[model samples]
Target: MRRQTQECKEYMEAGEKYLDCQDRQLTSVMQDWPKDINHLLLARNKIQVLRDNMFSQFTQLKSLDLQQNDISMVEDGAFSGLSQLTTLLLQHNRLKTASEEVLLPLPRLTYLRLYDNPWSCQCSLDSLVRSLQLPSNRNLGNYAKCAEPLLVVGQKLKKLSVDSLCRDDNQVDRGTGGGDGGRPRLPLIKVKPEATSMCHTYVFPKLLLDCSNKDLDHIPSDLPSDIVKMDLSSNIVKHLRPKQFLLSKDLKLLNLSGNSLRHIDTAAFAGLLYLRELDLSNNSLHYFQYGVLEDLYFLRKLSLGNNPWVCDYNIHYLIYWLKHHPGVSYTGLMCSEPQEFRGWRVEDYVKTYNGECPKDRQTGGMDTGQGGQGGSDNEAQEVAGETGEQLPRPLREKKRNRFEIIRLS
Candidate 1:
């Protein structure tokens, strides 16, 4: 017992308590365990049977890993008090049967793994099969197959008909076929490609998804709705189609930096109402079209660095929207456009849009001398005022003649 205890590793991760007792050859859970642990792992053990009240002490446990064990039978009350348990893994075990009543104590169970087990397909396993096939239990017992009754061997338990398990003819209505209960067959669900198989998924510390550096040319379909943060940076996504992120309504932080993004449809972010931080840096973006950012009402920070932002009339909308939303802190919006305005701040370029100068103090008239030098002086003064600095006279002269057209005599 002392050697087994020494093999177990108990530690705190991100302020959550965890106890890992995997590969300790534990036949049963030890009594010397902290009651406040949030995660408990007991995989690759020699556990055969689960007695009544097997884990009643760990009331606060959120996840239990018991895969690759010798567990064959589980008493009905084995998980009696695990009210907060959300994840349970029982795959690769030696079990042939399990009653649905054994899961009654796990009220919050959302993720259940029961695959790779020798499941018996008989009258006794009817209730468990029916429970696992419920539409609401789609994530439970996935990939589990029936191993007994040669007629239905290797059949997926989730797609198995409940009528085939029980022998009573009055229980289920018969279909066109013969010997079996003849229940109407359910069509197999079409498997859609998902990014979860390729990317890393983290459940604790805030449900994060990392799909960066995947060489993706488009956003992956069917993103999880509960993810709070997603990183899709350093890819080849060039266009953001309409309603691209409509599924991930709970997203708070989105990192799309270091991509080849050039165009974003107006409704590309239609459902991102709660987005707090967005990173669009190091891309090939030019400007945002009107109404493209209409949905980000609660945005806090925006990163637009290292992009070739054109300082044209089309770029005015971005500055206009940011001005109205004073709460959003932004960076790196310099002009990389028409040679005259190259390297100018986007805010300063937008200020010169009106082209109206104030009346002179001494002459009481608009100073319209030398190729709209008056307007140039006003633009320079406004830029200086915004940054709390004075513009050099040479730079001001250079800007004054930028639009002047000389006629050959």
Candidate 2:
């Protein structure tokens, strides 16, 4: 069979079972999609809404790309018949809420992208949030950021706790009473003390907190005990103390991106045993102690991009960790120091360094050099001679005589 490309506002590459209708100003799904098509690309269009049974005919479809559209609504049963679908991309849309009825039908879906949507955090979205929490659909958590309700703007949806969404239910008045002058009065219910203590709002019935861009200088001490997700991005916090998050042991997702953080204690993340994703991007970190991340056995995704990483021998700690954990997404990680290795990827640099200390640096014995001061007994240090910025105080405390590159036993 010869390969063919069909052109008609939308085009299809025949014999390959692929269709490309992107950037065609489409307002709806094209009904003339070839019955044998297995992949469809409909991104960058004007699709405003998804109607019921829209893709019912494409039972064999395996991948659907609808990113960068104007989709605001997805009617129930809209995705009912695409049982073979394994990937769905819906980023950069106008969706306000996603109900389980629109998502539960695609049982084989293994990858879903729903970021950049104006998700209204409320009880209406609780079911969809719960569906995404299932182990089978957990990877979708990385693309579930919210873009609404003022408080949680730019916060990931999966980080939200159920208490944040359902706390409003506690405010409903259920008492039936008679008022003065024979007028019936609606009951007045008091807000929960937990909800009143923090400057957060609900996204799913008490599961997530949208605390992004709150100008907070420190973690809120009064956060709910059972809260699972917290967004502390775009804040002014400079340090992370060990006790700051001592009570948030159940936290699964933490976003500390776009902050002024320069120091993180080794014990700062001590109790976060259940943490899955952490975003420390766009900060002022030059080096991070691997000990801080040692306790996160379940961590799958970590974002350390957009920071001014020194990329010296000291960075071996992070590179070694990243190489061992292939599942972590270390995007935007680049070197910003060392004239020789600048602009190189930290991971790539680690390959070239090969766990060897510089020829001039002392390696056989602990030398309290310029970079080794205040370091702990086990940390390895390398000097870049004032390349970009000095390492933070907490990170400079650990000194090691030799570069012990992690080797899987």
Q: For this target, which candidate reaches the highest TM-score against the unseen true structure?
A: 1
Clashes of each: 0, 26
Task: Write candidate 2's Cα lDDT for 1-409 as tens digits.
Answer: 3243344233344444666766778887756667667787777789888998898888888888887789999998889899998878776678888788887778888777676566877788888887777776765644455544444544567777656776664222223332234444443333222221233423222246566877778776555455688888888999998756777788899899999999888888888888899999999999887677777778988888888889777788887777777877667788988877788988888788675555554334544343336452333334323222233333445555353332211
Q: Write one digit per residue (lDDT tens) for candidate 1, span 1-409.
A: 1223447877888787888887897899878787888998887789999899989999999998887789899888999999999988787788898889988898889988776677888888888899999898877786677776655666778888888687752333233355456455444344433444345444545667778998888997757677899999999999999997998999999999999999999999999999999999999999998999899999999999999999889998999899999999999999999889999999999998754544321222323344246555665465457545454453244445334322211
True-vs-predicted CA distance for residue 231, candidate 1, Å? 1.6
Global CA lDDT computed for model 1: 0.80
Task: Report model 2's TM-score to 2 decimal places.
Answer: 0.43
lDDT of 1 at 9: 75
| lDDT on C-alpha atoms for all candidate structures | 0.80, 0.70
Residue 79's lDDT in candidate 2: 92
